[model samples]
Target: MTVESPAGPSTGTSTGRRWHVLGAWLLADALALTGTRLAAVALPWLALTTTGSPTAAGVVAFAELAPLVVAKVLSGPAIDHLGARRVAVGCDAASASTVAAIPALHHLDALSFPALLVLVAATGALRGPADAARHSLVPVLAESTRQPMERVTGLASTVERTSSLVGAALAAGLVALVGAADALAVNAAGLALAAVVLGLGARSVGRGVPADDDPHSYLVRLRAGWQFLRRDPVILALTVMIAFTNLLDVAFTAVLLPVWAVETGSGVGAVGLLLAVMAATSVVGSLVAAAWADRMPRFAVYVVAFVVCGLPRFAVLAWSDVTSAPVVVMAVAGLASGFLNPVVGAVFFERIPRHLVGRVGAMSTAVAWGLMPFGGLVGSALLALLDLRAALLVAGVLYLVTTLAPVVDRRFRAMDRVPVEVS
Candidate 1:
């Protein structure tokens, strides 16, 4: 099947090629996410193993994610102007190189704490734009294939989560077999392969903004994206709600859970097990959403998903002595979270015009990721200031408040309304 290019369909474009296009993009996305998950594991492992300090680990985490948020915020206009496909390839290549550097430096005995921080930060910075570029291609692929946008969105989310599961499993084995630095090398190779797959399979997407299409200053165009987000009630509500929840989730996954694993004698292996299980269950949820989510009221499904996905695991950890209970809670929570990404993706596409997808999407991502960089630091600090039970309790309560905000806010009710596709 020939896929249509963003500029226009070529003579070779055919409907039969739709599956091929979708498959290519999906493979690329999954691979990219897999590499990201590996890096997530490997980076922290490196810090913890080398420094033997949770504070150092938190600093490394902060260095990686903080630059990522800032870079994502700034990448919108550039993504639009440069073209999504181009940006995707460039970012992936850069990521591969940067990731490869870590293992190399370690092997050479030249890797310092500060240098590791800088390298991880570089990888994070590239990741934000690459993700935006990849996500921005979804609607284009859907339109060309004449597929339901929501289906594609659900499938994409599922693929990403599945990759996370696979990646986590890979990280654990690689770290155990060789070392954390070697696992990072594996991440680099995955990213490079992803870049190749995307380059070959999805050539027809991402036309990019022409030079003369919008001659406005970069900041002016950025303001335009911000304004669009501010005016859209449904998107606005979703953004705020997700942002708060993301921070809590990050804290749980990056700090609280790992600490729990160690404190309970469950070890790093248990942490990997929990993460993999949660991601696998999340994939199950995404599949269910793909099959039936469109038939339900999106807001209702979304709100319920939030309720299940948030706060419960923290509470479980705080109250239960048996590790098995937290696993069950996490699995159930993951199952509930499956419907979330598709709902958000569909709503976003329905409301934001294609021409503005890059910018608006970037702004939306920036907001969602805003607090994530500090999650590890905060979680560590909370642990230091309070006992494990108290820290978990505080996090659980905060999560509860954030998750409930949407149910109470009138603006979020707009999600119940039918979505219309923007031109």
Candidate 2:
């Protein structure tokens, strides 16, 4: 278990700890994601309860997410130049301070809406780079431990899902017991702890560009990342496809599902139950992927998982009246969805050169998530133009088409090839 650092065993420090780096990275990632999920719930709730205006709450959300996406797109070069470990530690520490300010200011009766907005926005901006840096660490950590990328990314995905489930529940309980402001303080504490864990344990990993490496200007490095993505058909296609699917997912979760619940007389509780079921099953799926995904064909698994996880839920919601049908569909879909991230993560790590991981990964992620903010708007528009059932049907068809891209396009065949750095 005594694995060498990227610089090899000559560094004279890799012989003592077994899996400490990977363990610390996972723990840090879990803590950070949990804090994020807590904020996702607490921030909007605080805005709504304090301002008593839904529009103000919406504005707060927009303020946070818009900057986050922009920052992710721009932070890639910084991550590559300064190193993932440094950037992640710095951003998380800054995020902790910024998040702590919200509760502190509110307790003193001095937290205005505008000030709250700025704080939330700062946390969001910091989060973008923090997240990208963490993602860039997976490949390095996997190599250091001599572990397969599928296993590492699958574990990461599982940690992500588990943290989200736990964090949302925790946020709700904390908000109910002590209010959103106090819940936010707990979030700040989690982030600060994550920073400490990562800074101390991951010192040898993600050490950034070497001094002897080419020192390209920031803009040139950024452009090089974009150009690489544009030339690589597989990653580019995956980016576009995932972006559209993300939009549809947001639409389904944010608008369609709730509207369906109301129209079907299932109530809000049923909506929560359905999502809970999906998330739980998805965790199980991630575990399976973590164990066996490396043995499976990446292309086939990716295609099948997307198909299962995408169109079926929409189809079930649009067409079925049986109470148990949607639940069953969600369980199946969640299980299938679990295999997705591991496969995609392995492909990206296998294909992208180590030097460009930060820039390429950041740009790809930013693009994939860029459509999410508009998802609710798109769903609302769909409902405006079509009936509920019809809108669901349309969304389902779109998802089906998007997921089938891999099967139709030959470029995705490269997913099955041996790992080779794209230079």
Candidate 3:
């Protein structure tokens, strides 16, 4: 796959060597996310078990996610300011230390609910910088001319989604075999591994832009990213679409899937397997997208993939009353996700400026993710009100259509033929 960013200033020409750069980012990133998600999943469970309080769980989630919102929103500027490479490498190391400290605390019984919350929060704080740096790296590694950044970015998405595959299986296996605390210990090591991978291959944030660190209040600096995003039509629409999906997807993962599995009598084991299936298929799908993305019209592929994503949620609700119906529905949803991400990367990469990539990307991702707590709440509520099948289908269909509406534009449809000649 040609990992070129056509929308930005022409930087370098493509060669066969660049995809290795892409894969390295993917593997390192996969580990980064694997650590993040595993800690998210395992820490909460460990806290609940130790303290036996729902408050502990809520605090952990809040501590981690709240920083995500602020960090995400502000990270764009931070990335621009700090340089993507330093921020990426440094933050990963910070995150590793944060998670690693937890197990020792647990052993000594120093891992109180408050301490755990703070530890995870520290990890969360570092994550935003790492996230921004990685996104900036994508375009850098690719040639500005004749490079398909969407393909490269899509492969990144593959790793992001695939992290769920690695995290869940790792957490389940290690936690089940050892325990959540021990599993968390293992997760810290994985994070260190990821840090080494990306840190070793690290490049500077690129030569094209300087991080504007004019002394100012953080919010003042952060608002620059918001203002930048709001003014760009393509970016605005794409950000909205991405945020909506983020909200719905996070809800499904944290709340709905568990409920659906239990209600359907599918057992927790079967439900866990659902993600593994999703990840495996997603890897293939991402590879396909990366390999073939340059050949097709980006918009047409997006519209179709959007439908594939949306249609499956309805399948969940529509099939709720039938036994095994939930399984079939989830399978389809997994299949659809495999195809959805490439389209997402294509859309996001085509519109934004290179200099703005980290801030804009992080700002958008953070804002969208800020809705995740809401998603967790909504998913729980909907399950209480209706079955998992019904709640998910309704939410999925509504947001799916809402997001896909952006592609209805003629300008967007014409983006693919615009050529890789960066201005």
Per-residue lDDT of 308-346 in model 1, one digit per residue for the tens?
888888999888765688789889988988889988898
TM-score ranking, high to low: 1, 2, 3
Q: Per-prediction RMSD in angstroms?
A: 2.8, 4.0, 4.9
Clash numbers, per candidate: 3, 0, 4
lDDT per residue as tens, model 2, 1-423: 222223233245463453787888899999998888777666656765676544454566666766777899999888777788889899999999999998899889999999998898898899889999899888877776678999999999998877766776677577778888888888898899899999998777744245425566788889988998899888988888899998898677656775677579775445556766677788888999999999999899999999999999999999875559999999899899889999899888888887788899999988888887676567777887898899999999999999999888998988888654567
Any idea what lDDT model 1 has? 0.82
Question: What's the lDDT for all of these models?
Answer: 0.82, 0.81, 0.65
Global local distance difference test of model 3: 0.65
What's the lDDT for residue 28 in model 2?
94
The better-scoring model by lDDT among 1 and 3 is 1
Q: For this target, which candidate reaches the highest TM-score against the unseen true structure?
A: 1
Top lDDT prediction, candidate number = 1
- Residue pairs clashing in model 1 are 1-16, 1-17, 5-204
